[model samples]
Target: MDLIGAYSDDGAPSPSRSGDGTAALAVVSAAPEVRCGTCHARHFPLSSCISNGIYASSQVDASGYALVESKLVSQEDTKFFQGANTRMIRYNLPADQMHAPVQGPTHPSGRKADGGLSNHRTGHVEDSHLSSYAFDEQYNSFHSDGVAMDPSRPVAISLGPGVGAPPTQPQQKRQRTQQSKVAPAPVDLTQPFTLRTRQPWAEKAAFPEQELTEEHRAYLEKEEKAEKDAGSGKGETSIFHGKALEDYQGRSWLEAPRDLRDDSATSFLPKKHLHTWSGHTKGVNAIRFFPSTGHLLLSAGLDGKVKMWDVHNQRKCLRTYLGHTKGVRDAWFSNDGRKFVTTGYDKVIRLWDSETGAVLGKYGEGKMAYTVRFHPDDDKQNMLMAGMADKKILQMDTDTGDVVQSYDYHLGAVNTVTFIDEGRRFVSTSDDKTIRVWEFGIPVQIKYIADPAMHAISAVSVTPNKKWWCGQSMDNKIVTYSATDRVKPNTKKTFAGHNVAGYACEVSFSPDSRYVTSGDGEGKLFMWDWKTKKIARTIKAHEGVCIGSAWHPLETSRVATCGWDGLIKYWD
Candidate 1:
C-alpha cells in the first residue's frame, strides 16, 4: 500500500499488462492528451491542482468520475533512490516511485482575470515580471540577528547549516553598517526620534515603563492595600511588588550574617581544597554566590532542588528551595540578592525569595531552559534572561511573564548567557560554535565570534573590563576573543590541555580578569593565567564532571565549584 490515499481490502483497478502481447499494448497505452485550460488561460489556481489534481491527465474511475492518475517514476528522468541503506531501519519501503502531476501555472489570489474584484484596481501598480525572483535556488529567510528590511535580501549561508557555521564576514559587516542602530539624538528636525522593537517577541518598554495587564494591576492593588493595613509587621515587604513572603522569618532574614571567611586574606587563588558542601543526593549542576551577599553560595542540582550555603561553613545548608519538577539546570541571583531565578530541564522559570526559599512566581518556557541570568542593572528590574534548548536566547519580565526580548541567532541550543563589562553588554554561547556579543537593550548583535569548524561552545565568560571574551569548547580547550568595540573576530586564541569532551562544562573568569577557570569531564578544575595563556593549576575538585564554577564578586580569590558528584567545593 502507498503512504497516501485510502484503499479498500479489494483495491480498485489499476493499469496492467495482459498475457497476449498485442492486446496488452492497447490496454496500457490509453494515454490522455494532457492539455491544461487554466495554464492556457491567464490564471491557474494552485488549490485546484493540489487538492483535486484537475490539471493532470485523468481517466474515469469505478464511480464514473475523473481521477487524476498518479505518475510512475522514470529511471532515466531522475535518480529517485541513489544511496539508501537498509541497515538503519528495520524494513525498506516500497521501491516503486510515485509523484504528483507536473507543475501547472499558479494563480495565487493576485492574478485573477480583469472581471474579478482582485483585478479591478486600475491605478495601483501591478507586480512586474522584473520584480519577481527568477532563480530556482532562491529561498526565504530572516537575517540571523534581525528581520531583513528588504524582502528579497539573500542570505550568504544556505539552508540547514545546523548547529553552527561561520557567518560570511563581508555580508555581516555590510549589514552591520546598513542597519545601524539609531539611538535617540537631538536634531533640528520637527519630529523627535523614536525607537521601536526590532524583534516581534521584544516589548518596546523596559520593565519599569511597561504597561501593566488587568490581572497584574488588580494583584498589585490588593497587595498594596494589604501592606498598608498591616503597618510594618515582623518582616519587610518587597520594594517592587509590596508583597511579603508567606514564610517570612522574624528579624534575621535580611540580617543573616555572611560566611566567616575573611575577604581581605588572599588576592590570588591558592590551588588547594578548602571545604566541601555535600548534602545533595544527585549531581550538582550549577553554583553561584549571591550578588548582594557574596558569602552565600547558591547551587541547583539534578535532584530537582536548590540549596543555599555559607561557603565558610562546609556542612550547613542555609536553605532549600523546591519548585521544579525536574533536575535544575541553572540558577541566578538578583542584584539585590533578595530574589533569584532558577531554570531546569522542566522548562519552567521560577523566581524565588533568596532569604525564605519561597517560590514567588513562574513562567513556562516551551523548551528546556539551559541557563538563566538576572539583568545586571538595578533600575527596578525583574527581567530574567534564559538560554533555551530551542536555539534562542529569551528575556522575560518575571513580574508579568511578558517577554522583553528574544534573540534567535543561534543555530543550536543556547548554552550560556553572561553579563560582562560592568553589565552594559552580555555574551551568549551556543552549540552552533558561535559566541555573540549583544548590548543590554539593542536588538541586534554587536559582535560575533564564529569558528569555522562548528565547535560547540558549551559555556563562555567575559572579563570584568569587557576587553576579552572566552568560550569553552567540547574539544577540551578555552578560546579567547577580543571584545573591544571597533573590531571583528577573524582570529581566536586557543588554550589547550583540558578535557571537556562529552560534557557541557561551565567556565568562568576571575574578578580581576587575570585568570580563566573551567571544570572538565574528569571532575577536575582547570585554572589558567589569561596573560600567559598557560595552565596554572589542575586539581581534582569532584568525582564527576564539574558543570558549574564561579568567582566571588567582592573577594578576588574566593571560588566555588559544583559537579555531577553532588559536592560543592570552595577554594581561596
Candidate 2:
C-alpha cells in the first residue's frame, strides 16, 4: 500500500512503503546545526525544524526505504501536480537560501518540471509548455541562472516570439546630444525692456496713448448743453423737475373708492383682466397696493425703476421713483403710505418719500438685497428688514439709516422674510431648503425646519387672519405652515397644480383668507380654495413668467399680476 506523507519542494505529497504492505510512517529528527551546548544537539518537533528551514536525515532500517529532507513550496505552485501526474522528491537547503532560485527536476516523460510558468490571465498551470515563445515578448518563467524574480515588474507576458530567447547581438546604450546656450542680446539700461512682438498685419502689437483731434474737440464744444434748471418751469409738465407739490400735499390721490370699503367680506377669484399697465421697459418683478386703502398701486421692474399708478382715478402713472442702478427685487410702503422702501440687485436699499419721489435714506453693505419688509406694527415702522444675498437678514433703522441687527444663520441666500404672530416673530425661507422662525429683535433662530423632500422656498405670504403662512416652493407647489409658535408644516393644505419652479413667484392670500393665489413660470395665475386645497381658477395673465401677484385688500374680486413680459395687469 502507498502512504501519502507530506508536501515536498516540488509541491506534491511524498509517499513511502513498508515491506509487509503496511502503511509507512515518517521519521523525525533535528539538525546538528541546532545545538544546546558543547557536544550536545537540541532535539526539536518535526514541525519546528521544517519551519526553521533546517533538516536532518536518519538511516533507514532493513524494513523501510530511505527518507529525504523536505522544503515548503507556495500554494500556487502546488496546482501544477493535479493534472501533471508527477511524484514529489524533496531536497533541502539552508534557511538563508530561501529567496534564491533553484532548478526544478525533470519528469521521466522528457518534460521539464513547472518553473513558475503560470498563465497569469487564466491563472492555470500549463503542462509541457517547452516552447520559449509567447504572444508577447515578455516572459515570467523563472529559471535558476543566479537571478531572482522581481515581483515589482509589470506582468504583460503573453505567448509570443522572443519571450525567453537569447539576443543574437548585444545592444548598446543610447547617448543624448548636448545643446549649447547662446548669449542673450545686450539691453540698454536707458530704454524700457518689453517683450511685445509685432503681428504680420499690424505695425505694432501694443496699444498707443489716445488723444482727440482738434476738429473732434471743436465739434464737441459746439454741441448744445442744457442748464441745470432748464426744464423747471411751473407748467413744463415734467414729473421729475416740474412743480406738482400742491397736488401731493392735498392727499387727494389717497382717497379710497366707495366700492372698496370693507375687507371682512368674502373674496372671489378674479375672472377677467381689467387694466394693463405697460410703462416698465423690462420685466416687472413685484407689485404692491397702497397700504390699507388699495387706492394706489406700486410696481418694481427689472428696468431699475419703481412707479405708482392711480388705481382709483384715471389709472395713470402718478410718479416714477428712479434710484436703483439694476433690477429692483422688492418694494414696500410704510404704514402711513408717506414713505416706501425699494431693494434691488445693485446692493442698495433706499427709503423713499412716497409723495415727492425723493430718496430719504439708503441702507446696504455691498450685498444684493433679495427682499425687504417694514416692521408690521405702526410703532416699529422705522425698522426695516431686508433679506440679503449673503445669507443674512439685515434690520436697519430707516429713520437713522443705520443697520441695527443682523440674523446670520441661513446656509444659503435668504429669499423671503415675513412677520408672523402679531409682529413678535418672523418666518424666513432660504435657498438652503430650510424654514427658520426668529424673534423680532433676536439674532438667533427659535424654530428650524429642514427636510430632504423640501425644495427652496422663494417667496412667502401670511394669511389675513394670521393663522397660517404659505411658501412658494420651487417644486411647483405652495407649502403651508402654521403661523403660531409651533410652526408645524401643514401637509393637508398644500396647494399645487401650477409650475413655479426656478422663478421666485410670489404667493398671496385673499384679504378675507378664503383663497390662496400665486403666479407661475408659464405666465399663468392660479387661485386655490384655502381649505380644500383645490385649484379654483387658472388665468392666462402674461406673455412670460408671471412672478408676482397681489389681491386688493378691499375689493374681493380685484387682483394685480406682474410678469417677465414687462406688463402689470389688473384682473377683476
Candidate 3:
C-alpha cells in the first residue's frame, strides 16, 4: 500500500506488527509530485499550482491509478493552494524556460470549457484532474516486504513488494510527526502571511521526482562545480552559470528603447562593484567625472599622474595627465567639458584642455596648493578656488595668472574649500577645527561654525539645494547643519559607523540629497539616509584607507571610489 492509501494486510490502519511485535516496512506513496521540468527541481509552489486552482494530479482511473478520496482533501487544503503566502517564489518566468502543462487530471475551474490544458498561454493542467477523486471505489490494499533494520547499513533503506518489519514512524513517508512542536510554523500558502520565514522549503524532504539517477545526478554536480570554478572569469561575463541550465534562450528584455520597455528606467544606486582599476603605482587621492553627457571618469594618484577612463568601460585607461611634479592632491572638471584642473604638492595648479590633454595654464605661485575646485558656472573658466598649505584660501583669475582674491583667516592648514549659493559665497574647513563661511572676493570671514562635536572636520559637502551642509569629522562621525541659518549653525543630524580616525575621508550627498555617503579610514564606504540618520550600507571596498569617493552627478546608481591601496573602483 502507498503512504496515503496505506492499510494493513487485514485492511486495517497501518503500522502493522510483525512476529516480534515490531512495525513493518515504510509506506511510500505512489503519488506523483510537481517539479521543474528542465532542472528537475521538485514541487510546484502553491502559488503556481493555485494560479489555476488545485494541483493537477497525474492519477486517473483509465490509467489504472487508484481513485483519490474527496474526504481526504478538505476545502481548507484547496484554499491553502490559492493564497499569496508560499514557501517558494519564482523570481522570474522567462518564456523560453517555461514548462509545458502536463495534460492530466486538472481542476474544474482551472480548465477551459474546450477540455484542453487550462491557460495554454502560460501553463496549467486540465480540470479533469479533480475527477480522479471520485470516492466511489475503495482503493486496493497492497502489501510490502518488511524493512530489515540491518546494523551493517548506516542510512541505506531497502523496500520490496510483499512480507517483514516496519520502519520507524519518523522515517515513514508523509507520516505526520510532532515536527510542528519543535520547529517553526510552515508558511501556509492559503493564508495571509505576516512574518517572513526564509527558505522554509529547506526544512522539508524532497518528493520522489526530486530524486535522480546516479548518472544524471553526477552530470549535474559536475556541471555545477565547473560553473563555480570558472566563476565570472575567463570571458564568462556573467556570474550566472550560462553554460548549463541557463542555456535556454529567453525573449530579450531589451527590445524597445530603455524608457519605453517595461517602464523600468535606469537608476544609479551602487548595487555591485563592476570593475577595479589598479593603474596607479601609489595611493589614489582624488576622483572626478570627465564632465561628459555621455560617459567618462578621471582619477588622480599620489604617483604624480592623473588617468582618464571611459565610465562604461573602466578597465582601460583612456588618457593620462602627467604634469604634476609631485603626488597630485586633487582634480576637478569645468562645468563645460572643454577643460579640467589639478593640484599637487609641487606648489602648483595646472589647467589643461580636456580633449588633447595639453597644459593650458599653470596658476599657483610657489605655494603647495592642497585643494582645488572649478567654478560652478559654465562660462567662468577664469574663476576657480584653491587652498594652500600656507593657511590661505586663494581664488585664481586664470585669465591674468593672478590670485585676485585671498582669505587668510584660518590659523591652521585649510583642508577644503567649496562654493555655495550659486558661488556668491563659499565655505571652508581647516585643521584648526573651524568652519568659515565667506562671501566670494571678500577678504574676511563672515560666519564661523564650531561645534563641540565637530572633532576635526576633514571634509565638507553642501546639499544640492543649499539648504544643508555636512562635515566629515576625523573622530569617526559625520555632522550635518542647516546652511540657511548660519547664525545658529543648527546641527541637523549625525551619522557614524565608518571609522574616519583622523584621516581625510571624503563625503558627499546623493544627487537628490536623500543620502549622505562617505569614505572611511578603514577602506570602506558608508551611506546614510538623511532623514533616518541610519546607515544604509557599509561596503568593504579597498585594501587600505579609502580617501575619496564620488557619486555620479546625474545617475543615482554609479559611484567611484579611491583608496590608499592605489586602486580606483566603480560600483553600480
The numbered model that scores best in TM-score is 2
Candidate 3 wrong stretches, greater than 4 Å: 1-269, 292-294, 313-315, 451-453, 485-488
TM-score ranking of the models: 2, 1, 3
* Per-residue lDDT over 102-141 for candidate 2, one digit per residue giving the tens place of the 0 to 100 score: 4456445642213333345554333434345541223433
Once fitted onto the true fold, the runs of candidate 2 whose alpha carbons sit more than 4 angstroms away are 1-249, 255-260
Best by lDDT: 2
lDDT of 1 by residue, 1-572 (tens): 23112223466422223222223224324543443454442222221132332332232234432323343444332233334452353322222222211246434664433222232245223343533353322223333532222222232444444523444689889877766664423333344343434533433332235698999999899766644532322122222211332225444434435344445533586566778888789999888786635667788899877887764433367677765556888888787778888887666777888766566776754478888888777874687788888988888888788878888888899888887766677788887778788987676898887757758777766677677777777777776666665434424457778888878777787777777888888888888887677888887888878787888776678778888989898887
Evaluation by lDDT, superior candidate among 1 and 3: 3
Global lDDT scores for all candidate models: 0.65, 0.73, 0.66
Better of 1 and 2 by lDDT: 2
Q: What TM-score does each of the candidates earn? A: 0.54, 0.62, 0.52
Q: Give the per-residue Cα lDDT of candidate 3 at 557.
A: 68
Question: 1-572, model 3: which lDDT tens digit per residue?
Answer: 24434345576543323321122223222334556333344543221232223323332334333323332343322322323446663343322223323345546566353343345666553332323333221111112443433322233234554443454556664344544445655555465543444344443432223668999989889766644432322211111111232123642211111222221223335779888887889999988764533256778889778887655432567667676646888888887666788887766688877656677787874687878887787677689899888899998988888889899999888988978777777889898888888988889889987757566677887887688778888778887766674524544588888888878888877777777889888888888888888988888989889998887755666788999999998888
Of the two candidates 1 and 2, the one with more favorable TM-score, higher being better, is: 2
When summed lDDT is taken over every stretch of 10 residues in candidate 2, the lowest stretch is 227-236
